[model samples]
Target chain A: MWMGQSSVDFIMAGCKLLDEGNVQSFLDNTDIVLTDCDGVLWRGNQVIPGAQETIEKLRKLGKKVLFVTNNSTKTRAEYVTKCASLGFPASEDEIISSSYVTAHYLKYIVKYTGKVYTVGPQGLAQELNAVGIPNFGTGPDVAENWKFEDYTTLPLDPEVNCVVVGFDKDFSYVKLCRATAYLRDKGCLFVATNTDTGLPVNGRFIPGTGTIVAAVSEAAERRPDIICGKPHLPIFDTVLKLHNVDPKRCIMIGDRLNTDIELAHNCGLGAALLVLTGCATLEEVRQKQSSNSIADQRLVPNFYLPSLAQLGTLIDSLK
Target chain B: MWMGQSSVDFIMAGCKLLDEGNVQSFLDNTDIVLTDCDGVLWRGNQVIPGAQETIEKLRKLGKKVLFVTNNSTKTRAEYVTKCASLGFPASEDEIISSSYVTAHYLKYIVKYTGKVYTVGPQGLAQELNAVGIPNFGTGPDVAENWKFEDYTTLPLDPEVNCVVVGFDKDFSYVKLCRATAYLRDKGCLFVATNTDTGLPVNGRFIPGTGTIVAAVSEAAERRPDIICGKPHLPIFDTVLKLHNVDPKRCIMIGDRLNTDIELAHNCGLGAALLVLTGCATLEEVRQKQSSNSIADQRLVPNFYLPSLAQLGTLIDSLK
Candidate 1:
């Protein structure tokens, strides 16, 4: 009945939340578990040796496990593709990206029935249209080119409702000129997908959407109107609703301390399990748990794990 | 009746182009005609020294005149409004602003179907939309509220095909971020209405859209998609078409030597004017002419007068 055994068990068994009493109560009450990707399951590409098996083991014990990510550029489909390619079993609904949250937020404000310009990929644009926010040019063989300066000359036309910023490399003088011009005249809205600084692929660092977002910030003289992913609304709430469990009864788990741990704490969900992989290194977790913390202390993970597979009896004992 | 004394008549009567050439040939032959607005009979107020009436004088006498200016933000409509208000009897088609030329050039290479975000007043944005471009959001509402960075993340989207740059003093961090982010996105284009470094209002200097555009460029790492306005095209071409005449017979009559003179030279019409009223002074014109002689020689006027009212005798002599 133990299902499997590995070094992951010792890590989980010895886990201690900073507020031990609160964590214990949380463990006793929660029926659902939310997990962050990257650090929890793998580092760069080599899975933490037993992540998949540990997840499978946890599921067999009747604990609902979920995964979340803050990277906004990739769509749910893209995330699914990545997971599948990474040899993980994932369904579209099982994963979330910042882009998803952004789309949902826009829907709350108004439907974009006009043009939308971005420093992002096709995925982010597709998300907007998917939610009834019609794109600027939606017809076949539609050929249109515009410069930033053109916006200033024609601000009230109502053809453009929003400006979505994501990751882009083609930033240039011409585009900036036109975009800012429009900003001053019509007062177009601004929204950012996510704030990840960089993404690791093939053992190298590639610029993330955050860098692009920051660049826009430097020009526009402000930050995102709203950030759609991580520690924001709906992502955590949606997951809780799906399982019919209260947030207080849910245990959020993830590899990155910042996204997973912070999200869980911000939403009143209990306990974050820090795994060493993805964006944050093990050394970083130790650093935060020790003095130089920019974040609030209550958000710290309840438990620490070298690998989920490193836990054995704790899986059974927790139940 | 000779409005001016017979003494002025000989000077006006003996004018070479009117006496020896036909309208088309004379227009083609004359390099430039400079005039003033005050004494000229404009639509009403004060075409001032030689503004509109001077152009009328040149037309009957077979001289070519090019209108120019230093006020970069005003669109052709604004110019038309001023001319009409001043009783200049000119169409929006006849007058030119640095803004008009800026918008004109942007329309040429860029293709866009979405809403353009703009900063300046209605004249600028309206001018662009009239030619078939659209803009995002409207006055003090969305475009004003949304910063450039937020443009990427929200429901509106980041795949902006183009951005139009203009001036806005309240421009904040959010707008800069959105624009910067949008520009970095691949394939998005940028444009500026004008490259004015600063704006003059109430005797104080403020950074113009050019400064903001440059900031965006540095962040995004590219040059302007295009700079419209001032000696640029599609503007001059539009003006020529308004007269229902060929370019060989068209002229630009403006107050500023650089904008008017340079505009004419660039368009293959002719550059010839300077007034103490605009940004470039007579001293500046003289220095510029001597320094860059190609367009510089053309900068000198065939006719230099204190005002246009002195042309009555000259006008009758043409008959």
Candidate 2:
């Protein structure tokens, strides 16, 4: 269903289905594999069939595997525990979560010394704490029985020099007020973990970190100074700093094209593999393929598979 | 500081200082005056000097006076009370607040029948109640000790077919979750009162309705179907339906350039007068005047005074 010369060129360049003819060369050319967790490995609590076997087979082939997720609600330690529980055994070093990257960016990259006013969950705060960065504002900070006028008089911490926004279940008007107030200084750095708009749950959706970040950005009248997440440069910078891997030999496999596939494109990775088991569809890939916009074109993946199970089957046939 | 021929033409067409040579003609051409409340008449509780006298003089000169405000936290009746207390006595019919227009739009314009899930204050609900529209979700709706998982399971009102977002002091994550859920249905209408980012309070700022709207928009992955406030046509449409004043004979005066000045430009009003007592400054007007962008040019006002006090002085000289 490719349309023109441009579409044909894009199809030939990417979005090809992994087949017997291409599987051997694809594996031979890739040394590092960065796989997104939420949709690729599992949908919520249930793991995708053969995902564990595919990862195991990749590891047995001497391919370095890393669980790269934009989910900022969990620390690397927490992700490791979750990964083990889900049948994909992983260590802290192999988990490149957004929270870990944010902490690493702040601690090592920015070398920030002042206190951080975080509008996030406990795990996000834990990551900051682990990096020895003073932070607060995790739990409910709602203004109970207080008028809008009270919010103006609410005392702000003078020590706060940074505001980090992530997935916050306890997000409230008061926290938004405080975040805006701190950001008014202009010296205070505004950072966001990720901008995933919604999280799918039980076939439904709940507001994600993007929603919280949007709220703060609106109030602050500014976009985030830095975003330590997929599709952004900070997370990739962290990956490069921590691990030695050739960019042209790295493959990123994710179910979402905007975040995972775009991340691969942004980082100049060798390949982006789209799996039909999650948020994106083959129809979407075709739509992007025909679009003239470079931004939309970048969402097109280099490879496609029905699921990782199919990849596992392909590998078994080769053996 | 005008740059090119276009800049000179823009300045000659608008952004002229209201002086004795122009005051009489400007006043004679206007049959109705639409004035913004927050920045123009008063900043917080204290009123701008001579603002009340200026309104009284406008009325004595046989001009219809209407208080137009983007603040959606107050009903028209409540606005009347606020005006009376502030010495610029006004009737409920003279008050055209965003909340009033929102209710009017949903009630008469759209002829909406289903229950409205509101994320605003008591005054917003009062406005909807006055129009006999069933609404809920005003006060604090936080997820006390519950996790993010609980938000996905939170019961949604089946009757809710519309989500109205406005200035809410008790805005919380649970409220955002519900709003996002209701807006997920493509059939459900999404409405916002206004998108004022922050309210300047006691020299500081508190997050305004825009922050909440931004959050909900991000989560829902869609913009509001309609916004009933300044610079948008819905509120002006409400004004036209309620009053017999001609657009060419009506003038809008305010302190903000984006909302107040832009509204006058959008409505084909006779003149837009800028008063430097609140949000905007003379420097901003110059910036807009010099900009080549048509959108920026639209923000430039027809006449400007240091404050309403200067307009009062000009009128006294004429008498």
Candidate 3:
């Protein structure tokens, strides 16, 4: 009955725990499975237990599995190689990263042919290069002898029509000024890889792309035209268009409820499953469920599992 | 009649053009006068036309005058020297800069003796030193080769209980991460000098202190506890306390409506005058006067003057 309605009520009503009985039911209708890489597949360098087995089992079952990640530090090719090295059945075509999705969006959806003023890393540059998007303002640290007047006389390329922001170790005041100057022209497209407030670094979180993006936004006093990442429609649409996913037959699995689960709901996917291996816990899921507001209710996932390790056992039972 | 009322209506009603007849009447009761330095006194290194003469005339009339500025790049002694060089009579006691006010607020109002984590220039460090506030997190450039793991394990002083942000030419990701980490304690005091979005550089504007402040705020997901700059009460209260002036007998004059004129209204000053010599034009003041909304109406200055040069003539005619 709730199959056609694209409303919050329909999504909330379908949320429950994915059990052994429901695993077969979920797999029967869902042909495509999208899972987040970092928390779901691996925490850092180490892989999550039984997660690789579940991905391999899904591929063996003729399921079109794709790895969707918001970590824009690595290009799509890097993600593919990293995934394979970790013993997961992965390829370049099956990896959908924020940087890659951003490139795809700029090339296909917007039909943007102009040069990009990028404030990001080499990985972002590589992805843009793959799609034939020329970029400037990426490398080169701010000069030590930079005067206040130099910013006014900044030599900007006239062909640059887009300002892209992402995670860059070399992010500096020069890059910030150039991006802000390009964005001062209201017609120029403003795009950010992801607005993840913090990124995990050695078991602790530090400032992420959002912090960099926020500085430009505040200086310009304007919001980005689009953010090509999770919880936003551009990245989800990018994956859907590339893979030709059926909304009612696709499921999303991740560890965080806000980004992974909310992204699933926003894209009108079949279901979203939350695991306890990431930022969210069981107590948080329960708290979100008890909340009456529509926004809080949206954070509620369709299913809860202790870990993706349980999915490997369920898939094994099928054999 | 509306001497005690703090409503926006009273402030808006008190606005009028400073004419020959009103000049004497306005000055008769007003003994203390505050003014912004950049566009009002001088634009860059050159002083405004007749600005020095007007300051001299006011002093001759035995009126107390103070220069209120948000430029945190220079110390109070530097400002006094710069003012004298520009032919404007000024002293350290007659200057109120954002850095000085920030130091005063921490030392007097908050009574905070703990060390500070500063993301700003040497001017701020000097002010903090003057007040005997031990500080860290300034002057040093970001490491040449910083890894993500370094941020998680970055060396931080335990005594640092306050995070101060201002215009820093040496601002970097390392400084942003350290400030965010210090602020993660939740008990740490977060203070910003000013939120000027852009600073004028040879006619064009570049990113200012607000841009740097915003990045830390976004990463920490918390607003600064105190912003000791124009339109904020702390700086205004600092000047009033240091000079022991009456708000009912004080007046503010500047070239911008937002920071300068708004500061006057917020402080319950007797009058505010807008001069068409800076960022704002005459048309903007007219539009604000015609606006129906209370917020917009507050932007309308009580009086409009072509320039401070005209005030010098009016003062001479009286003699």
> Which of the numbered candidates is closest to the native, going by highest lDDT?
2
Q: State the displacement of the C-alpha of residue B311, model 2, in Å, after optimal TM-score superposition.
A: 1.6
Tens digits of per-residue lDDT, candidate 3, B1-319, equal 1235753654558457778878887788688888888888889887899989898888899889899998988899999998889998688999999999999999998999899999998999999999999986667566676666778998889999999999987788888888999988899999999989898778667899999998999888899999999878888889877977778688888888878887877777877888777778878887887888777776778787888888778888784
Docking class of 1: incorrect
Assess every candidate by TM-score.
Answer: 0.46, 0.95, 0.95
Report the lDDT tens digits of candidate 2 across residue range A88-154: 9998999999988999999999999989999998888999999999999999897668866787787
- The sequence of per-residue lDDT tens digits that candidate 1 reaches over residues B1-319 is 1112322322222212122233344344554442323223332242455445545666666554444443444566677666667655555554555555555555553445555665443556666776767664222222334222334454435435676666543333334455555666657777766555543333323345566565556556677776665545545654554445444334444444544545555665532333344345556555654564544554543233333443433454454
TM-scores of chain A across the candidates, in order, are: 0.75, 0.95, 0.95
Error of 1 at A241 (Å): 6.4
Model 1 ranges with Cα > 4 A deviation: A1-28, A108-115, A136-157, A169-179, A185-187, A237-244, A290-299, A311-313, A316-319, B1-319
**For each of the candidates, what fraction of the native contacts does it recover?**
0.00, 0.90, 0.74
Candidate 3 lDDT score at position A25: 77
> Residues B1-319, candidate 2, lDDT per residue (tens digit)?
1123433343359688999999998999989899998878998999999999988888999999999999998888888888999998989999999999999999998999999999998888999999999999998888768765687788888999999999998898889999999999989999999989888988888888999999999999999999889888888888888998777688899999889988887777878899999899999999998998988988999899999988888989896
Cα miss at B277, model 3 (Å)? 0.8
Error of 1 at A122 (Å): 1.6
User: Per-residue lDDT for A1-319 in model 1, tens only?
Assistant: 1112221232233346323334335446667777767766766556767777767766776667666777655678888887777667778877766666667667754444556666565667677767766653211111034322333343333566566766543433334433443343335777767666555555434445665565455445556666666665556644654456766666677766556767766676645666555565556655565654446353356676556665433454453
| Candidate 3 colliding pairs | B15-B302, B16-B302
For model 3 the local lDDT of residue B258 reads 79
Give per-residue CA lDDT, model 3, range A57-167, as digits (tens).
888888899899888888888988899888886788888899999999999999999999898877899999999999866665675876788888888799998999998
